[model samples]
Target: MEFKFSPLAYVPFVSVENMIKLVNSIGAETFMSELAVAIEEDFKRWELFDKTPRVASHSDVGVIELMPTSDGEMYGFKYVNGHPKNTKEGLQTVTAFGLLADVDSGYPKLLTEMTLLTALRTAAMSALVGRHLAPKGSKTMAMIGNGAQSEFQCLAFKAVCGIENVRLYDIDPAATAKCAANLKSAGVNVVSCKTAEEAMEGAEIITTCTADKQYATILTDNMVGDGVHINAIGGDCPGKTEVAEAVLRRSDIFVEYPPQTRIEGDIQQLPDDYPVTDLWQVMRGEAEGRTHDRQITFFDSVGFAVEDFSALKYVRAKIEGTEFFEHLDMLADPSDPRDLFGMLS
Candidate 1:
C-alpha cells in the first residue's frame, strides 16, 4: 500500500447573516420550492427518520422547546422559545438557535442562530403548502398577527405564489404598524385592517402566525370565504391555537406529521376521530389537495424539523466556497474510539 496522510478538514460555521445571504443568493423562491421538495423527499421515507416529538419545558413566563429530527444520516435540532409576552418587555417573542451534525461522527458541522431562519423557513413552509391549496390566479393574501414573522411571510408569498397584495392585521396596532413600515419598500399593496374579517376579504390565501400561546380563535368560520386557503402557524404547542374548532371542522385540514400535530396542531381541539389529511400523501400524489375550488383547505403548520434539514441542505449547496464564513472546532478527538471521555481533558 502507498503511504498516505489526511489533513484536518475544517467545518463551515454559518452565522445568521451568512445563512440569510446564502438563501438570498439561491433566490427565495428557489430556496422555498426546493425546501418543499426536500421535505417531501424526507417524508416519503418517514420510517427512516428518528422522529421524536418536540421536548417542551413550560414556565409561568413562557415556553422553551427543543425539536430534533434525523434520517440516521444527517442530524439536526433547533432550540426555540415562545415567549409571547417578551415583546411587552421590549424583547423578541421567539428566540431560537439550531445545529446540524453528522450522525456517524456525532460532530456538529454548523451552529446558527435560528431566530431569523425560523421566520424564513416558516414562511417558506406556508407558501409551499399554499402552492398546492391556493386557487389559480390567486394574487392577494391576508396575514394575521403581523409580528416578527410577518415580513418574512409577506415576502414568501410574493416570491413563491406571485401574490402582490398583502392585507395585515394584529391585536397590537404597533405591531401592525411595524410590519407596514418594514415592508413598505417591497412594492406590494399593503393594507392595515381593523379586523380579521376585513383583512380576509378578496384574499385567496389567509395566514395566521400569531404569538399567543392560548386557544384564542383568531379566525372563525364566518370570517372565511369559499376557496380560501388558510395557513395556521401560531397554534403550534399545547394550549396554543389560532383557529376556531368550527372552522377546522368545516374545512379540509392538512398537516405535516399527523402524530405530533394531533397534539400540537389545530386538530388538538377536535375529537380524535375528526378527519385530517397528512400533507406527505399530497406531496406524493397519493392524496388529493384542494379537490375543488369551493372547498376550503387549511394547512396546520406547527413548524416542522424537516424544514431545518432542508434549510441547512440548501445553505450548504449554495455557499460552497463563499468568503462570509468561519471554521469551527466543536468536535472532540480521541486516540481510542471506546474512550469517549479521554478526549475531554
Candidate 2:
C-alpha cells in the first residue's frame, strides 16, 4: 500500500479582493444573518470553546491585539490594530489579518487579510444587536464617531435592520462629510449633524465605533433617549468608553460575554453589582430581549472572539473552489507523531 499526501503545496492565502468577492457573492445580508446564527450557536455551547482574553500591546502610537479561540477541534486567531493617527501616515486607522487552522493537525487551513472583514464583522455584530433588541419599524440610526467604521455601520443598519436614514456626527466635519458622500453614493440617506446630540434626535438605534482609544465620552446621558438600542463598539478596551456610566445604569445593559466585557466594554465603569444580561441567554430564549417599547437597550460590543470565529467561517465557506490562499511552510510533518525533536533537527 502507498500513502500519498501533498506537503510541498502552497498555503491557501486569501487576499482582500478575494474576500470582497466571496462576501458579495454570498450576499452581505445573508452572510451577516448567518454569522449571527453561528455566534449564537457558539454561545449556546459555550463550554466547548477554549477562550481567553485577547493579548494586547499598547504604545504611544497605537494598539495591536491578538485574539485566539479554539473548540478542541478547530482554532482561529486574528491580528488587529488601532491607530487613530494612521490617516496622517496615509494608512487606515485599523488594519487587520487573521487565520483559521485545524486543531487536530495544527495547520492553518486559511489565512486572510481581515482589514475590510473586521469592519464588516464589527458592523454586522452591531446590526444583529439592533435586530434582536430594537423596536419594530426601526428606521433611523444615530452614528457617532463617523470615521472608518461609519460607512460600514450605516450600510449594515440599512441592509440588516431596515434602517434607511442615518444621522451622522464626528468631531471632524470633514470626516462626516466624507462618510456622507460615500453613503449617499451607496443609496443611503445620510444626514450630517453638527453634534452627536442632534444625530440622536428621532433615532431608533445608536451605534458608537469611535477610535479615540481613550476615556472619551462621546455619548452623553441626555442624548440617549428611550426606545433606543445603543451598540457600543468603540469602548471595547480598558480606559476607553463612549457612553457615560449613567447610560449603562439606566438602560438594560446587554453584552456578548459579560466576563471579558466587564474589563473592556462600557460596563467597566459600573460597579460589580450593576445588573446586565448576556446576549446568549436572549438567543436561547432563556431571558427576555426588549421588555417594552420604551425600554432603553445597550449592547456593549467589545468585539468578541466568537464573532471573529463566525466571520472566519463565512470567509472560508466562500473560498471553496477558488485558490485564494497562499501556502506557507509554518508547520512540519514527520512520519512519527512523538518525534518533535527530529523535525527541528
Candidate 3:
C-alpha cells in the first residue's frame, strides 16, 4: 500500500522580504483595493466574530498590545509594540508580527510579519470607511502626519476613494519632504505644505495621524469645516488623541468598535456614553452614514482585530500556489497517537 499525506503538519511563514515581494507583485494600488474588499467582507459579517478590545500593557514611554479575534474556525492575533521615541535612535516607532491558528486542532496555520501588513490594512480600512462616510467628490486629502504610514494612506485613498491630490504636512520638514518625494511617481498631485492649515486648503478629506502619545490637539474645532470627513488615526491608546473635543461634539462619529474606541481611539476624549455609529452596522446596511452633504463625519479608527484577521486570511489565500511562504516545522507529529513518549524516545 502507498501512503501519502498533506503538508498539514507544518505551518506557513511569510517573512518580511516575502511580504514585500507579495505586495509588489500584487501592485500597491490593486493590493489596497483588494484589502479594502477583504476588510469590508469581514465587517459585513461582524456578528460572526468574537470581538474584544486589544489587551495592552502601557508604560511611560510606549506600549505593547495583543489583538486577538476568532470566527469560530480560524483564530488570529497580532503582537505589536509602539515606542514613539525609537525613531530618534534610527529605529521604527512601531513593529509587529502575527499568527493564525486552527480552532478545532489548536494548530498554527500561518505566521507572518505584520508591520507592513498593518500599515496596508490600516490605510485600507481608513479609505474604506471614508468611502462610506466622506462627502461626495472628495478628491483632495490633507495628511497631517508624514511618518512611516503617510505614503500608504495617500496611495490607499487614491486606490479606494479615487483621491487625486494629497497635501502633506509634518512638524519635521524632512518627514514631509520624504513623503512628498515618495509620492512623485504615485500618479497623485503631491503638495508639501508649511502648516496644517495650508495642507487643509482645497482638501475635502482631513487625516490627522500624528504619533504623539499625549492628549495633543492636532485638529482644532476651527480647522474642521461642516462637510469634510476626518480620519482620526493617531489618537489610539489611552491619553492619546488628535482632534479637539469640540470638533468631536459637532461631528457624526463612527467607530470600529465602541468598547475599543472608547479606550484607544480619539473618542476617548469624549464621554463614555457619547453616541457613535458602529462601522459594521453601516457596512451591513443596518445603520446610516453621512446622511447629509454638510454633515461632518468622523471615523475614530483604533485598528480592530477583525481587520487583522481579514488581512491574515487574505494573505493566506493569496500565497497559495506561490513561493512567497516557507514551511515552518513548528508542529509536533507522532506516528502513534498514544505513544508520545515513545515517539520522543
Candidate 4:
C-alpha cells in the first residue's frame, strides 16, 4: 500500500550540524544579542507562562532533566543531561534537544538540537540580567572557571552588556588558555589570570560557571566587593553550589523561581525561608533592580524552562527563510480521519 503523508506530518528539524551553521551564518554575538531580546520579551510577560522546576533524575555520576513550559499559545520542552565525568571520557558534560508545539492542535512545530542553543541562551540571559543589575558604567567582567561556557559568557557580555574587558581564570591553565585563544578576535580584551581573586580584580561583573556535582565554594565572602553584580550559573542542581553562605547572605539575591532556586541555585545554601527577589518582577517594573551603586546584587540563575522556550521561539523565527533546518516526517497523517492503524498497514 502506497501512503501519502500530509504536510502537517512534517516538522522542521534543526540538527546539530545545521545549528552550528546557523550560529556561524548569523554571527554568534548577533545571535545571542537577538536571543536576549526574545528572552526579555518573555520575561516581561512572565505571568502568562506555565512555570515549574525542571524534572530531574539524579545519580552519583550525573543527572538527566526535562524542562518544559508554555505561553498559552505555544508549548516547548528540552531534554538535557549533565555528567561531569564525561569530560574525562572525552565527551560533553552537557547535551540537549528541544521541541516546540502548537497549543491548538498539540502538534509539534519545530524540533532542534539544544546543546549549543542552551549555551547561547544561558550566556544571553546572564548578560541580560547584568545589563539591569550591574553597576552603572560597568566594563570589565571576571570569568571564573574557564570551560566550555566561558567564551560564550564573555562574548555575550561584550555583545549585550557592553563589557569591554574579560579576565579569565580556571583551575586548569589549559582551559583558560583555550578560552582566551577563542576570544582573541571577539572584540573584547581577554586577560588570563592565575588565581580567581586576580580575575576579579577591577571587575564589576563576576560570572562563575564551574562544572562540579558537589557543594563547592567558588567565591568566599571577603573575595566579593560592594557594587558588583554576581552572575552565579554553575550551581544548577541539588548538592551542587558555587557561592559561600556568607556571600549569599550579604548580597541581595534575585532568582527566576523561588521554589526552584531554593533547591538548585547558590541560594540553596541559604535557609528555605530566606527572602529573594524575582527577576520577572524586576523586568515588569514591580521590583527594584540595582538601587545603590555600593550595594551587592546577585543573580542566581538555574536555567528556567521559559528561557529555553524563548530560545526555541527565536530559532524558529530566524530559520524561516534560511536553509538551517530540514523537514522531518514525525507524525502520522491518515488520509481518512481516525484511520491511523489502516495507514500503517
**Could you say which candidate leads in lDDT?**
4
How do the residues 1-345 of candidate 4 rate in per-residue lDDT, one tens digit apiece? Answer: 232588888899999999999999999999999999999999999989999668899897998999999999999999999999999999999999999999999999999999999999999999999988999889999999999899989999999999999999999999999999999988899999999999999999999999988999999999999889999999998899999999998899999889999998988888899999999899888999999988899999999998999999999999999999998888888888788789767
Using TM-score, rank the candidates from best to worst.
4, 3, 1, 2
Deviating ranges (above 4 Å) for candidate 3: 1-6
Q: Model 1 clash tally? A: 0
Error of 1 at 261 (Å): 1.2
lDDT of 1 by residue, 1-345 (tens): 221211133466678787778777776556666666666677677678787888899899888998999989889999998887888899988888888888998877767777877777888888878887888878999999998888888887887788999999998899899999988888789999999889898999999988777888999878888888999988988788899988898899999888888888888998877788987788778899988889899999987888777676655555667864677655444456688786566
Name the best candidate (by TM-score): 4
- Per-prediction TM-score to the true structure, in the order listed: 0.90, 0.89, 0.96, 0.98
Question: Which scores higher on lDDT, 2 or 4?
Answer: 4
Alpha-carbon lDDT, every model = 0.82, 0.82, 0.92, 0.93
Please state the error at residue 333 of candidate 4 in Å.
0.9
Q: Flag clash pairs in model 1.
A: none
Clashing residue pairs, candidate 2?
10-327, 11-326, 11-327, 12-325, 12-326, 13-324, 13-325, 13-326
Please write out the lDDT profile of model 3 over residues 1-345, one tens digit for every residue.
Answer: 122323676889999999999999999889989999999999998989998668889888888999999999999999999998998899888999999999999888999999999999999999999899888889999999999899999999999999999999999999999999999999999999999999999888999899987899999988888889999899988888898999999999999999889988998888899999999999988999999988999999989999999999999999999999988877666666676676556
